[model samples]
Target: MIAAAPASGPLWQQVLVALAVFAAALHVLHDRAPGLLRRLRLGLARRLLAGRAPLARLLGRWVAPPPPAGSGQTACGACQKAGCAPRPADHMRNTP
Candidate 1:
């Protein structure tokens, strides 16, 4: 039931415009609402693989589950610094 593009432009041009719009929308959604995107992806995968145990297992392998809580690590490497803090001896030696 999709409507055809106007005949004023070539089919290739119409396809390109549609693809550009789709890409832009995806980028905006990815930046503005990442959680929503993740949920949508999970929902889509579930719907696609509904009632299929083997397929579900394959999908699970492809999309690993999130790490357990209190793992002390994050996707971003902003965890505790190792040996970055200045010691009292260093401060004393540097003092004028």
Candidate 2:
């Protein structure tokens, strides 16, 4: 039997092919098999963060949030000026 070339042309015509392949691989690994494959992703993220200050800062920005205070959340300036609650240690302990 003889095979014929596709009328639309090559299967991988452009960079789209590389992107599609990458997306498909990620989908298959993470979406189709999340339970087993997720650890691989977690490990990759951890390794990427290790020993890289920019990556560490990016990850820190991603994971940590400023301490919350007051009612409604505010993204920029103009938040309430009330200071955080003071601890009991702030008061003097008499040593009679």
Candidate 3:
């Protein structure tokens, strides 16, 4: 988790710090770049699952499924360029 960099400090500095942290998190979320929102949900659930607090783990249990296995391309090419994440099948009828 991001430690608030002196949220009590000057407002402009706080805003800049917040934005930078947000951008960094966004980059981490999107670096794979193919399935953006799917990745985000997966990532958040994983984080919540691994969190120290019991409340977080409880929330995770409500949201996430068992982790995906062999999710990457096998060259058997399960779903074309899309990684075989469980999410894609639920929305197969809709466009991203």
- Lowest summed-lDDT stretch of 10 residues in model 1? 60-69
lDDT of 1 by residue, 3-42 (tens): 9766978889989999999999989988999787777777
| TM-score of structure candidate 1 | 0.49
lDDT: the better of candidates 2 and 3: 3
Candidate 2 per-residue lDDT over residues 36-87, each given as its tens digit: 5656656655665674689675774454434347645554354545544434
Ranking by TM-score: 1, 2, 3
Instruction: Return model 3's CA RMSD, one decimal.
Output: 13.7
Candidate 2 positional error at 80, Å: 28
Off by over 4 Å in 2: 1-13, 56-96
- Report the CA-based lDDT of candidate 1 relative to the real structure: 0.71
Off by over 4 Å in 1: 1-6, 51-96
RMSD of 1: 9.1
Q: How would you order the candidates by lDDT, starting with the best?
A: 3, 1, 2
Looking at model 2, which ten-residue stretch has the lowest summed lDDT?
60-69
- Residue pairs clashing in model 2 are none
lDDT score, candidate 3, position 17: 95
Could you tell which candidate, 1 or 2, scores higher by TM-score?
A: 1
